[model samples]
Target: MEMNGSQRIEASREQVYAALNDVEVLRQCIPGCDSIEKTSDTEMNAKVTLRVGPVKASFTGKVTLSDLDPPNGYTISGEGSGGMAGFAKGGARVVLVPDGEATMLNYAVSAEIGGKIAQLGSRLIDGTAKKLAGDFFSKFSQIVGPQPAGDDAPAAEVAEKKGWVGRLRDSL
Candidate 1:
């Protein structure tokens, strides 16, 4: 399957680019992510649990970043296995453009799956992929992007309310 979309982040292109390369940022942004460890500057290993349709499984994956372009963008590719459940492989080209103080992020993604997971039908897989992508970007924006005005709650109180993501941001 293939999908593409864009988002306007309330941060500079440099901030967005740096956050995209940060392991902690990604760990927090990825839904169902158990952990992410950087093997190198351009490589990482991750464990995640996901549910598609009625199948729920844990996936271990390796991700690699290529085509370095600083604050512009890069290509990211990854593959993961879920034991008997299936395997998934995909790649995405991400681009970041400055929009005044904010950044406009664009991405084009292509993915494939095999084994029992593939049998779940394209509609199910496609929907799940879209949802996962949306979740990641939304969380990433919330973390790296600027907070809206008039929210003056203390960091401890806000973190408690926002859960792990908020706590992670506060720690950073």
Candidate 2:
């Protein structure tokens, strides 16, 4: 699956970038995330739990940031396993752009799963991923403050573009 989102943050570009890099902030921001800790400057570990259809499971994984352009952009990739349940791995490219008085936080994420999770089918996985992303940003905006311009059309477009299937399942 692929994902995209845009958030207007109250914090400055540097502050938002720093927060995005921080494991503590990310852990709190991620829906179902239990913990996140830095194992190294470029790598970190995370534990997240969620339910997809009838299956519920927890995942522990490692993530690493690559091709960083400090306070501007970078690619993050990670893989997590859930014992007999399944495994998930994905990468996301994040970019911070200045938009008038707010910083526009943009992300492009792609993810894949194997084992039981993949068997759940694409619709469930796609909706679940979309929900998770939406949950993360909704809370993130609360932390960053509100958008004064009041136009959220751009953000909605980004979210819709994430999936090829509009409703049940379209096509890629």
Report the number of the highest-lDDT candidate: 1
lDDT tens digits, residues 64-150, model 1?
999989999999999999999999999999999999999999999999899898999999999999999999998899899877556
lDDT of 2 by residue, 1-172 (tens): 8888787887778878788787877877898899999999899998999899999999999999998887897899999998889999999999999877678989999998999989999999999998888888777766565544546756556556765556325433
TM-score of each: 0.88, 0.81
TM-score of 2: 0.81
Candidates' RMSD to native? 5.5, 9.2
lDDT computed for candidate 1: 0.93
lDDT of 2 at 55: 92
Off by over 4 Å in 1: 151-172
Model 2 alpha-carbon miss at residue 119, Å: 1.0
